[model samples]
Target: MTQPSREAIQTLVTQCLQEILNQRGTELSAPLTADTPMFGTGGLLDSIGIVTMIVDVEQTIAAEFNATVSLADDRAMSQRNSPYRSISALTDYILGQLSEGA
Candidate 1:
């Protein structure tokens, strides 16, 4: 099977984030587009919100791609730039993982 492209990754990220936010009872003021930031610094989500998002992303990846991913961990916490910061960043992070055979 062929792997998805970068745009597909971004789309999935937005879908997962939006779905998870809705489940958390948080309606985003704006629709989650490619540029929508997951972290509160740029968008509507806070730290705890990102944590919930991480869990959702992990679940979606596992179910959809049969890939187990760790979205929230020491690497995330200690990084100068967080993977959940924005849609683009998150997409890059996920694609990197997919490339690494994660």
Candidate 2:
């Protein structure tokens, strides 16, 4: 499969976040969007929550794109600006990884 577009990836991430929120019984005051913070202060997710989101996103990408990629692997952990900082950053990271597969 071809690399998914940024918007497509963002949509997937948003869906994943919503699923996580439902599973965790957490309620969001607003809709999930690209600017929604995923970690750090005022972020929606804690460390474990971030990990869950990474795994969820990875699985979804593997299933939807037919490509196995690690979202919480060493490369991502070592990044100066973490991809998990927000929906937009994660989407960009996923897009980069998918392009690498291409």
Q: Which candidate tops TM-score?
A: 2
Task: Tell me how candidate 1 scores on lDDT.
Answer: 0.76
lDDT of 1 by residue, 1-102 (tens): 356688777777888777767777987677777777778576667777777778877788788777866767688777798777788888888887777773
Q: For model 2, how does the per-residue alpha-carbon lDDT over 31-69 read when each residue is reduced to its tens digit?
A: 777988887778899889998999999999888889888
Clashing pairs in 2: none
Per-model RMSD to reference = 2.1, 1.1
Candidate 1: which pairs clash?
Answer: none
Please give me the total number of clashing residue pairs in predicted model 1.
Answer: 0
Model 2's TM-score against the true structure = 0.92
* Alpha-carbon runs more than 4 Å astray in model 1: 24-29
List the global CA lDDT of all models. 0.76, 0.88
